[model samples]
Target: MIKTNRIRMKAKPAGNLSRDDFSVEAITIPAPASGEVLIAARYFSLDPYLTGFMRGWQGPDPRWAEGIVVGRFVAQVIESQDQRFAPGDWVQGEGGWQDTEVISADKLQKLEPIPGVPFSVYLSVLGSSGLTAWAGVNGVLKVEAGDTFTVSSAAGMVGGIAGQIAKKIGARVVGIAGGAEKCAHVVNTLGFDACVDHHSQDLQGDLATAAGAPITAHYENVGAKTLDPVLANIADRGRIALCGLIAHYQDMNPIALKEFRRLLISGVTLRGFRLPDFAADFEQASAELKAMVISGDITLQETLSHGLESAAGAFLNMLEGKGTGKHLLVLEEK
Candidate 1:
């Protein structure tokens, strides 16, 4: 028998989740039965959306139970009773906040090798965040060649990919991140045409300069404060693909958006969606993204922390915009 480590919610969080909101718990790993596999979690992903779950936010699912800590992760099959997979195969699944778990083989996605791309891409660029970005830019917004696009939380997993994918389609992409360093990385490292720091003293002015014309499309990941600025700069008849709202994740305090009605008056279209709601298109997006990554057209940056013990700290840091790219916690050896 094997022992596993998992992080469970200490209690339902009030506002701005802290380390006290979670605790590490130990559990026994059961052997795999027929059609089941025992997975050793390799990389556990920490996303800001988890904080909302900890706070009893129902998300898109009004029927979902409150305070449930649900998440996605990369794991390796340590033991399997299924014919499709064998021990030592790398897979991705909803591992929650754990180091190891036993789930049905059907629950996992088997990762195939792409010549140049690392396996981590399954947890990042070709994974949920990347797929979400692809769906938003290509499927929803449908950015066209020569269009101007703006993305909030530009240095984040989804935002960064959306920026790159927009640029790939020949659109001029601009990003808005929290700090100067992340702002620089988005433009210089991520190949965004321009980047704006939301923390800048003159954010509206900086955003106006980076926007480079009326914004044809805005990939909205940060809500409220950022959304208002984005609305002010959007072109008439512009489009918006609303993804996660991390800025308001901590504080659900009602933000009176003075520009809330701009969507109607400006003839802008704002589409809000959760990624899983469009999971049917994931396979198509995955294939396209894997090709782009293998060709070195896009880069995946991950800040990996050691052990399940670090999940809380890593998650909080992500909320504070301290970590760039995907924030991950390495659980154990694959």
Candidate 2:
């Protein structure tokens, strides 16, 4: 019997999520059963969407109960009862906050590390974040040259990459983030043409000024809290790629789109999507991102928190908008 640590999400978050919402516990883990793989976690990603589960937001079937924390991770196969996965192979999968997980082979995706590219990219840029951004910008929005593309949460993993992809498309890209620092990163690091500080006293006016032109394609990550202003500035016949609604993750009140009329009058196309919605295209999309990353056409940014337990604090920092780029927990060094 092997004892390992895992964060147990025992309580439905009442208001804002806190450390009390999760309890770290050690429990015995069984060896890989038939068609299963024993994986030693290397990296755990902290994403905003995971909060919805704790707030009783159901996703797919086989729902993530309040009793266990479900998360995405990069890990190495410690043992395998399946022929496809061999010991020492790296993979990414959906699992919990535990250092090791006994996962079925089908749920995991094999990751092939590119020369000169860090493995962390597999978890961040090439994982869910990259996939989400790709699904929106490439698949849904179909961002193209001459388009004025704007993205909310522009400093986040998905947002940052989305803006960069738009830049690659030769589009005029503007971003929306909380503070001045993040806005700077959106423009300077992420290569966005302009970035709006949503925390400003006049967000609508400021964003309008920065955009310089009506937004033609928008990648939305922050839901209604930031949608209204973006809506006010959208071009007629524009398109919106809707992904995360971080602001509403903890609240259950019916979402009221104050700019619903703008969407209607402008003949805007708004599509809400999750990563799982584009499962069939994951391989080709990820390959495209990987090639871009290797050729320096795109850059990946990430922040690492040492140790598995650091996930809680890292998650807190992410939710409070303290960290730039992707927030990841380092479980194993080398």
Q: How close is candidate 2 to the true structure, as a TM-score?
A: 0.92
Q: Residues 197-303, candidate 2: write the lDDT tens digits.
A: 88888888988898898989999998886899989999999999998888777677899988889988999999998788899999899888988899887788888
lDDT of 1 by residue, 1-334 (tens): 7787777776666666788877888877678889999888888778777676667745443322533355787788888899999988989888557777888999898988777666777888987889899999988899999889999999999999999999999999999998889988998889999998887777777888987698899999988778888888889999999997787767768867868889888999999988887789988998889888977678888888888778788888888888789888887574
TM-score of each: 0.92, 0.92
Quote the positional error of residue 47 for candidate 1 in Å.
1.9
What value does the lDDT take at residue 171 in candidate 1?
Answer: 95
Output the TM-score of candidate 1. 0.92
Residue 137: error of model 1 in Å?
Answer: 0.7
Q: Which prediction has the highest lDDT against the true structure?
A: 2
lDDT of 1: 0.83
